[model samples]
Target: MTDTLALAGRLLLAALMFAGTAQKLASPTEAQALLALASLPPWLIWPAALFTAIAGIGLALGLATRPLAILAAAYCVVTSTFHVLMDDPWQMTIAFKNWVIAGGYLLLAAHGPGRFALRRD
Candidate 1:
């Protein structure tokens, strides 16, 4: 049951990451605009999207679970800063959500991916 729960958690987190990646890909304009507003290079969206895709895949497969979870957590925290910069109140909510998600990733890092992982550690 622990393993099942861990698997479910990992999959749900992966889905969330994948959704963000898809959103970035489907409409680069919004992301690029955000980057511009943040005084970051707009081309950064490419690498950011790629990293998100890799993170999602890793989470889904439970590969390098601990290290990946840590990295994902850091990613979440960093991205939250961007969301915080948005003018919309809803975006601030999203920023807080990102921080909450980061906490989940940190917990996953501590607990590992359980027995269902491709490479449990």
Candidate 2:
């Protein structure tokens, strides 16, 4: 049961990351605009999107789960901070959601990916 729950959680989180990656890819202009607003270089969009997509895949497959989860959690923090800094009510929701995802990622990191995962550590 615990393994099942962990698997379920991992799948859901992967789905979330994949969705975000798709959104970014589907609208690179918009994503680039957001990056510009964040004072980041536009060139970062490609690498960021690629990392996100690959990380989502990695998470789903339970490959390098610990470090990947940590990186995902750190990404959540980075994005959450960006939204929080925006100071808009609408952006606040995204920030909140990122923090929640970060919590989940952190928990998964500490707990391992369970027996059903591809990688044990």
The candidate scoring highest on TM-score is 1
Error of 1 at 50 (Å): 0.7
Best by lDDT: 1
Quote the lDDT for 29 in model 2.
88
lDDT of 2 at 13: 86
Candidate 1 residues lying further than 4 Å off, grouped into runs, are none
Local distance difference test, candidate 2: 0.86
User: How well is each residue in 1-121 modelled by candidate 1, as lDDT tens digits?
Assistant: 9999999999999988899899999999998987887899999999989988999999999998888889999999998888885569998998999999999999999999989988888
Worst-scoring 10-residue span by lDDT in model 1? 78-87
Q: TM-score for each prediction?
A: 0.96, 0.93
TM-score for candidate 2, residues paired by index:
0.93
Q: Candidate 2: how many backbone clashes?
A: 0
Question: Any residue pairs clashing in model 2, and if so which?
Answer: none
